[model samples]
Target: MNKDNLAARRAALIEQCAEQRVGLAFELNALRPSKVMAGLPLAGYVAANRKLALGAAGAALGLVLMRRKRLAGVATSALSAWKMARGALGILAQLRR
Candidate 1:
């Protein structure tokens, strides 16, 4: 109601706002990685080994064309598993950075 009380209240409000700003900043910083990754595709992963992907594709095609059904199935499965593992490792490496 008085000048001193008003000033004190204003000071408290300012301090509270400052604290809130800092807390918000910290929270945003913590979420920065997730935010960055969200903007990226599939865990920020790309098949970097073009040669490997191409080779696998070629091998898969060959197997199919050769009419080796069982071998082609195994090769396809292995390639898929390798791709997944590579992606997971890449994500982990990026997070570590």
Candidate 2:
């Protein structure tokens, strides 16, 4: 191609690249940590009440440490119940088929 045609093609490519860069920057801005966290409901609540959330978390940790044995027994009972229910469901499904 001639010099003018090449120059015109180069200018078009440059404009296209600039447009892509701007679009990419906008997309990256949307994916930023602060923007992403702001969109989450829990994150917004925690951000609004940082002290309250921290206090609740600390209390939960303290309870878990103090009642570890009781928690373990409850967890074991729950697991047993879940397994029994799952087995019953499987048997019912097989009977239906």
- Each candidate structure's TM-score, on Cα atoms with residue i matched to residue i, is 0.38, 0.47
Model 2 has an lDDT value of 0.91
Q: Where does candidate 1 have its weakest 10-residue lDDT segment?
A: 41-50
Candidate 1 clash pair list: none
Q: How far is 60's C-alpha from truth in model 1 (Å)?
A: 9.8
Can you write out model 2's per-residue Cα lDDT over 1-97, one digit (the tens) per residue? Answer: 8999999999999999999999999999998867878869899788778999999999788767867788888789979999999999999999999
In candidate 1, what are the lDDT values of residues 1-24, reduced to their tens digit?
Answer: 999999999999999999999999
- In candidate 1, how many clashes are counted? 0
Clashing pairs in 2: none
**Model 2 spans > 4 angstroms off:** 39-59, 68-97
Candidate 1 root-mean-square deviation in Å: 14.5
Q: Where in model 1 is the C-alpha error above 4 Å?
A: 34-97
